[model samples]
Target: MIDEHRQDLAAEYALDALDPESARAFEAMLANDAELKALADDLRETAAALALDAPAHLPPPELRERILSRIRAEAEAGAPAAPTATAVAPSTEAPVPSGGGRNLLPWALAAGFAITTAALWMERGSLQQDRTALLQEARELRNRDFLAKVKIATLSAQVDAYSKATAVIVWDAEKQHGVVKLNNVPPAGAGKDYQLWVIDPKYPAPVNGGLVPVNAEGIARVSFSPDQPISKADKFAISLEPAGGVPKATGPIVLLGGN
Candidate 1:
């Protein structure tokens, strides 16, 4: 029988924050548990619909002031913090990366937050339309935060290195995932592919970043999310390589720029 602790994981699971072993355990349980599966599916659906919600509502006034006051009161009282959460019982699976896998728990939690918020406002004497307006505001806040967490870096063509080019890269350093947009690049013909490289103080050698296929319109766009973490990009460079990328840089460099 799954306990409340396990139930609480529904939100984390939906957010893909479950530990690997825990994730596997949850997945196994999910496969055999009809109710759990339904719950996960519902979360996924709600999260997907967040974008369609109405405009965001402004947060309650004085919320910040009240929070700060609490903090001050805690300091004055010299409150001792509770110990960190205890270790979870041993799990059946191995640990996995934070960003890995797709779990619907987070969406469920988001939906719950929105629904509960609306219910609260209604109980506080808000009308149906007002509650809906509140939900939209909450959606907008979540969407903004989600977007802000994603890191993006842009690079322009290095002088004397490329005829004409510009690039935009969106990367999640923690997740080691990113997409590269090499715009106005020279056409890469058959048997040739464009390779990207990462330069960071952490790695003496440049990381063998992913490759991009150039389109007829002179653009190469590719998305990558490596399992291993990549340091802050000191420099992003592009080079020509064979259909399959090489382990090291060997061909002529096409474009280069620093972060």
Candidate 2:
């Protein structure tokens, strides 16, 4: 029963749209249900990734009226309303042109065509922006990663399910600082988060590194350093943790690397 209720809240929780009470309740449930939590995390991650990948588009200004006028005019003529501008926002620019059911068809078709072209143009512009940003980010990451002196370890996804994902941990032992770059992992679902762990043999349990927030591409750059300096890191791993991260790992290990 609780799991059933949580299913409904999962997406909302991931989106942070749940009310405080609902969120707290969901978190409580997440603590005990590893399978449910893992599912939620995957869903949330995918949703986040999709949102980032999707382009935001606004319709051409005149597309709205051209559509509404045609519909209203059709009704006046006692004819069925024609299909409208599919991509347009609500029409606030102009009202239906006067003159009952007259020669508005041609103008409407032209306006619809113009709007479609304009939407494509806008989408192209958005895609260009995305490309520019991606290129710049890639350049910066390459320069910093390759040129800067650092220690790096390659991490492998733990299971076949995550074969597409990749991870690398870079650290400056002298500075006692590190960064984890995880790429191509599907986004964590709502109310679920990916977390990093530093496994030291001396310790009874793996020390929590922290929650990792990933982008739409499932790319996450997590900057972290352990609370206490260590002689050496035996290994590192990433797990699908509850949202905001748990004090200790209580979920499946998704990625792993040895020192």
Candidate 3:
């Protein structure tokens, strides 16, 4: 457990408010004491997080005009007033710098202006980062929205051999990918496996869309990527081909569905 004194030192150190002598002493101790170092690190992280929580405030809209007006007033006031009607004896004391008040006021005002400008620049940079993050998020959302609007086509048995079988193709045209869901599908013949195909007008022949593997329950949901890019999926079909499948469909069409 850390003592309150140590915790206080850590907090001051984290805020960078510790005197140089004390800070050096604390750092030396921190290097030797793991527990104290951990406490200091935690304080630093908390301080950084608190900084982010600070609300952003811009300088008042009228601040610039007010400063300019003050400068003009100071300049006018610095001018020697019309000579007094009655003259006085010259002072024996050494003269003060001419327009000392006027000079100090401008320097003060310039420092203030510089601080405000720096703050404004920092705020602008933070806003730009936020805008960039929002744009990236919007782009991701659009891509997801486009992907969600997939084309769903239902595949039915093409012949009495698979009259009881049913499948559905959920195709994403944008990604050129799709998944085939089957129900009540029977096992393929010995030495033969089921294959998937995508019929696209862009291709001379049907594009192979991988193979399908049905479980013992006669149901399955398999994902496939077509061998060639498909702009439009005109039709989805399942065929019986040799085991391990073929490059191009070379077997009887068992199930078929059209756009």
lDDT tens digits, residue span 179-226, model 3: 677777888868988899999998989999998988887776776789
TM-score each candidate.
0.43, 0.42, 0.44
- Candidate 1's TM-score: 0.43
Q: Which stretches of candidate 3 lie over 4 Å from their true place?
A: 1-149
Best TM-score among the predictions, by candidate number:
3
**Stronger candidate by TM-score (2 vs 3):** 3
Model 3 scores a TM of 0.44
lDDT of 2 by residue, 120-195 (tens): 6656665677678876765455445522333454466777777777666655555666767776898788889999
- C-alpha lDDT of candidate 3 relative to the true structure: 0.72
Candidate 1 lDDT at 91 equals 77
| C-alpha RMSD (angstroms) for model 2 | 20.0
Q: Which has the better lDDT: candidate 2, or candidate 3?
A: 3
Instruction: Single out the weakest 10-residue window by summed lDDT for candidate 2.
Output: 142-151
Best by lDDT: 3
Better of 1 and 2 by TM-score: 1
lDDT of 1 by residue, 122-227 (tens): 4454344556887676555544554444443445455454545655555546556666766567776789888888877787777888787879887665766543
Q: Which whole-number lDDT from 0 to 100 does residue 73 have in model 1?
A: 62
